[model samples]
Target: MLERNALTFNPGRDQDAQPVGSFTDVRELQQELQGHGIQFLAEADEGTTGPASFIVVDPDGNPVIVDQHV
Candidate 1:
């Protein structure tokens, strides 16, 4: 069995890796989650724009990554 697992979300791309017409920014997502009291293992700088990423652990101890590549 795999001991570690991670889920990644790409804000500006679809499952096929095509750019989307519109999507929420990664920073916004991070802020919203933080507001909800979710803690992050790693976080992107909210001051910056464009490509960024942040990591948070799920209830099951799996890492969830929100990565933006716009």
Candidate 2:
């Protein structure tokens, strides 16, 4: 069961990758996000994930995958 969020963010990784997300400006967004103390755990294309995104750790140590298709 899949539902769309108001923010247009995908709840699941594959579901999120299914739709062409509205984010076209990713570089600045990535930089701005990093400036806020969020460090990238792993880059999307760096390993198994083929998308161009980065991972950030939540306060509880959960890996939040921020994916961008290049």
Candidate 3:
């Protein structure tokens, strides 16, 4: 069996999966991380809006997923 874990962020949702009134867009977060020299394995399209996602690798080799479902 193949096994792995990832850290995920849902920008528009809370811990209970309820929508919040406002939250930072995923693209903006990506840009900020990029400015800090973070690289992405898969990237969200900055040109689009609404739900999107991106992936990056942690120093420990774990996948980090930043997904937005708004």
Measured by lDDT, the strongest candidate is 1
Using TM-score as the measure, which candidate wins? 1
Tens-digit per-residue lDDT, 1-70, candidate 1: 7587889989999999899999999999999999999999999998999999999999989999999998
Weakest lDDT window of 10 consecutive positions for candidate 1: 1-10
| Total backbone collisions for each predicted model | 0, 0, 0
Error of 3 at 42 (Å): 0.4
| RMSD (Cα, Å) of model 1 | 1.4
In model 3, which range of ten residues has the least summed lDDT?
A: 1-10
Score each candidate by Cα lDDT.
0.94, 0.52, 0.93
lDDT, model 1: 0.94
- In candidate 3, stretches whose alpha carbon ends up further than 4 angstroms from where it belongs are 1-3
Clashing pairs in 2: none
Winner on lDDT (1 vs 3): 1
Give TM-scores for every candidate, taking all chains together and pairing residue i with residue i. Answer: 0.93, 0.49, 0.91
lDDT of 3 by residue, 1-70 (tens): 6567899889999999999999999999999999999989999999999999999998877899999998
Per-prediction CA RMSD (Å): 1.4, 8.2, 1.9
Q: After superposition, which runs of candidate 1 have C-alpha atoms over 4 Å from their true positions?
A: none
